[model samples]
Target: MVMTRAANIAFKPEHKITMLCLSSSGQFLSWADQSGSVSLASVGKNHTLDVKGNWHAPGTVVGLCLRGQRAYVLDDVEGLFCVNQQGEVDWHVPVAGGGFSLHEGPTDMAVVDALGRLLRVGYDGSPTDLTSQFEGILKAMYVSEFLVLSFEDGSVKALNGSQVVWNRPVRGEVGESITALGMDASGHLIIGREGYALVDGEEEALEMETWCLNGQGLLFRSDLKTRLTHITPGLGSVVCGFDNGSVTHYKDNQHQELLNTGFAVQSLMVRQNHVVVSSWFYLFGVEEGSEPWKIEHQGMPMLLESSNDGSICFFAGEDQNDWTEPEPIGFFSLKSEARDADPSELTEWFQRPDTEPERSAEEIYRVDETVENLLTEEERMLMEKPPVIGLDSLHAALDDFAFASPDDQAQGTLNVDAESLLDDLDDQLSSMAMMPDEGLFDALNEEVVAPIAPVPAAGEDQVVTCDEDGTAVVLLDGLGSEDPQNRIVMWSWVDSTGQEIATQARAKVRLSAGVHRFELRICDSEGQWSSDTIQLTLK
Candidate 1:
C-alpha cells in the first residue's frame, strides 16, 4: 500500500524541531528545532542519528538552503549562518537589514533585505551588493544567469546578477507585494502577486479570475504586488504556493487553480518530475507533469526537502517532549514507484470541468422552420449533388452488367442477396421449361390489394378507417391535460389529388376518391404541445 500519511506520535515539547534540509547527494537529512538546535541524521542507513548543534538564538529557524557541504540557516533573529560538514558554524552574517527571503544557488547564496539590497555572497567569502538599482523593497527574487526581482513598488526587474537588464514598472500602486515568482520554459519572467501578471510587454492586473467561497470576486488585481510565498517550475508551467494555502499553476499565460490549502505553503521543492509542498501539518506531492497528491500528517510540518538525486523526501516538524516522543521527521522514497504510483488518483481542484454542453450525436443538428435556409456552410456548398437516377434515365442499368459482372450476388451485387436471387432465377427458368404455354401470374390485374400506411401513430388507425360516408371519428383520451393534447395524421388517396390534410379536432370531410394526407395536433391544458406525427394512405 502507498504510504500517504505518516504514523502519529505522542506530543513532546523539548525536542521541538521545525525545519529540515538534505544535501544534494541524499546521504544526510538535517533538521533544526525551535530551541535553536540543529540535528543531522543519516537516512542511507536506517535513519541513524548522525550529529546535531545548538545555535542559541532569540527567534525561530525560518528556512534552510543547502548548496554543497555547507548549509545556510535563516532565523528570525540571527540573520543567516553558514554551517559546514563538521556541524560547526562556518560564518554568521548578520542580516540586521531585515530581509524576509534567503536563497542559495550552485555557486553562491543571496539575501534580499528590507532596504531593497540584494547581497550576493560567493564561496570566496566576499559579498557583491546590488542596491542602487531599484526604488522599492525587493519582495521576491529568482536567480539564474539573470536575477529577477519583484519589488514592493509593483515593478519587476531583470538583472544580470547585479546589473540591470530590463525592467517593467507595474501598475499596482497599493504596494500589495509580489508573493511568488518564477520563469516559465519560455524564459519570460512570471510574477504572481495578489492578481495580475508581469510578462513580456503587458502587465495584466487582477480582473476577477475566479470567485471565492464567500461569493466575492478574487481578482488578479495587483500587478507584481503582494508577497509571493513559494515558486517552482515544472514542465512548461510555473507552480506557485501562496500564503493563502492556494496552489496555482501558470500555463500558456493563463492561471489554473490547484488545491486550496487553508494554511500558507511554507516550503515547495520540485524533484524528478514531482512537486513536494509543505504547510503546517500537510504535505502534498504533485507530479511535476501531472496533478498533486496528498500525504497525511497531523502536526503542521514546517520545512520540506527532497533528494536532489530524486531518491527520497524529508518532512520535519517540532516534536514535543511528552512521555511518548513524537516523530520529528518523516521519510519518503522518491524512486519507490510502488508507493508513489497508484491507479486511483484524485484530480486537482483547478481541473474540474466547466459547465458546457456534452458532445454527442443526438445534439449534432437542430431542425427548425428555417432548416432549408439555415443549412451549414459545408452543406450549402453541396447544392449540386446529382440524383441517383437523373432525368430520362433508363431502368435497364439494373441488368445491363450481367455479361461482364461476376456474381457478387452473395454480397448484394444487384440489390438482392445472392442465394435468394439465384434461387428465384432457378425457379423461374425451371417453370418456363416445364410449362412453356402457361402465362406468368395468371391472376395478374385481378387481385385487389389494400393500401398500407408507412408511418403509424396511436390515433392514425381511425383516420384511415373512415366509412363510405367520408366521416372520420376519434375518441379524445387524456385530452387537454398537460401531456400530449394533440396528434397529427396524414392520409394519401390513391385516385385523388396528392395534397396533404392536417387536423386537430375530429370531423367529416368530403372525399376526393383518391389518396389523402391527414395530420393530428394535440395541446395540453396550458397550451404546451406534443411533437408526434404520422403518415397513412386512404384507399
Candidate 2:
C-alpha cells in the first residue's frame, strides 16, 4: 500500500497558464497566462503563496524566467521585457519573429531568434549581438565557465566568450533530430529520437564501433525504440520519459528502468532523494526505500519545476472539460522527510465526504423550467402578441389576382382563338410525322460529356540532408499534375504555416534542418482547382 495526499498549496488562475518558472531559492514563483498577464509571488512557510506583483504583456507570453526580484518575459509580438517587483517595465526590446528561445545566464539573458540571431542582454538594459559567432542555434545553456550551443545541423559546440572551446559535428539519421541537450557530471549529453551521445571535452581521434564511437573522450550512443517525451538531468545521469509510459535513468553507457506509469509522461522532475513523474491524471513520487506514493490530480499537469536545492517542487496545469474552457490550477509539494506537517491542513476541493447522500438519476439530470431559460426576451414578446393580417393587405392581394376582362369573368370562360390553335397543332403534328425515326433515336441516346477538372500532384515525399551552411535548397515539383484540357494556368505552393512560398509549377525553396510540409494547388482555365500535399524531412 502507498500513502496518498492532497497538495499542500493551491492556486486557481483566471485564465489558462501559458508558462511558469520558479526561482532557484524556492522563494519566488512566476507565471504567465493566456491573457498576457505575468505574476510574481512570494513563497512563505508551510508552502504558502502570496502574490506580490502582476504585469501585463502585449502578446501571448512564450518565455518567462524568474530571477531575484525581476521577471524576464518574451512574448510573440513583443521582444523582451524586464518587469521589476513593483510591476514596472525596466526595459523593452523589439523581437521580430515568434520562434525565439530565452535562457537566463549568470549575469545576463541569452535570446535566440527565428533567424538564428543570438543576443545577450545585461541586467542594466545593455544588449550585445553575437550572431556571427554561431549559425542556427537550436538550444543553448550556460554550464560552468562555458556556454554550450547546439546548431540546426546536429552539431554541438562550447564557447568561452568569442573563442570556441570544443566542437562536435556528429549528424543523426534522416528523421532524427536533437531533442534534449545538457551537461552532467560525466560529460555533455545529446539525446534524440534515434540515439544519444555523451561527449567529454578532450582531444582525441575517431574510433568507430557497431553501437557508438569510442573516440572523442568518453562518448556513448545507442538506439532507442521508444520515443522520448521529457528529460531532466539527474545526480550523475539523466532521467528520460518516453511516450510508452516508461521512465529510465541513463548513465555510464547503460540505462536503468525506473517505473512505468502506464500513461505517457507529461512532466518530470528529479530531486535529491526521489523522482516525481506526472501523467495526465496523477502525480507519482518514487523513492528508494519505500513504496511510491501517488497523488490524483483534478486536472492535467502541464508544468513541473524543482528548486536548485531540490527542496520543493511546483506543479501547475488546467482542468479541461468538453463544454467549458480550461481552468488553471497550481500547487507545490515538499520533499519527502523534509518537514512534518498536519495532513488535514492540505485541502482537496475535488473530493466529497462519504456522509453525503448519493443523488438519484432524476435528480442528477433534472433541469428547471424558467422563462429566461426557455426563450429570449424578444422571442417571448413575439409569442405573446402575434401579428394580424390587415383588411387593406387582403384587398391588395385580391386585386392583384383579379381577371383582366370583366366579360370573360361573367361568362365563366377564357377567350381563345380556337381555329388558329388547331392550325398550329396540325402543323406541329405534320412536322413530327415527317421526322426520321433513326434521327430521333440517335438524339435520345446521345451522351453528355462533362468538363474534367485539374488534378494536382505534389510529387513524392523527400528526405534531404543539409549542406555545410545548415540549410538545404530543395525543388518543389508539381509537373506531375494532370488536366484534361492542359490549360493549368495557375500553380501555388504553400508551407505548413499557411503561407504561400511559390507561385510556379517547379520552384526551389531553402529550408532549415527539420521536417517541413507543403501543399500544392493548381487551377485550370475553366476555374476548376485541386490540391495535394508533400512532406520533406531535412537532416
Best candidate, lDDT-wise?
Answer: 2
Cα displacement (angstroms), candidate 1, residue 79, comes to: 4.1
TM-score quality measure for candidate 2: 0.60
For model 2, which pairs clash? Answer: none
lDDT of 1 at 353: 40
Poorly placed runs, candidate 2 (over 4 Å)? 131-135, 172-175, 193-218, 319-325, 336-516, 519-539
In the range 1-539, model 2's lDDT, one tens digit per residue, is 34654454346677777688888888888888868999988887766778889999987686889878899998766789989887889899877544267888777777766555577777776886563455467678776556667665556666665567576666543222355555544445444433323333432222211111123643665666666666666747677787677888777766688888899888888887577888877777766565656666656766777687666677766654322354445454555453223444223534433357888999879875665578988887888886778866655654524344765555654344567667878999998896668988898889977767888999999999999987887889998888766768678999774446566687666688999999999877665678999999999
Worst 10 residues of 1 by lDDT: 491-500
Best by TM-score: 2
Worst 10 residues of 2 by lDDT: 204-213
- Give stretches of model 1 more than 4 Å off: 1-13, 52-63, 75-79, 96-99, 114-116, 129-138, 173-176, 195-229, 242-249, 254-266, 288-292, 318-327, 337-539
**Tens digits of per-residue lDDT for model 1, 93-154:** 77664444577655666675434456677754467777454434445455456666766445
C-alpha-based local distance difference test score of model 1: 0.53
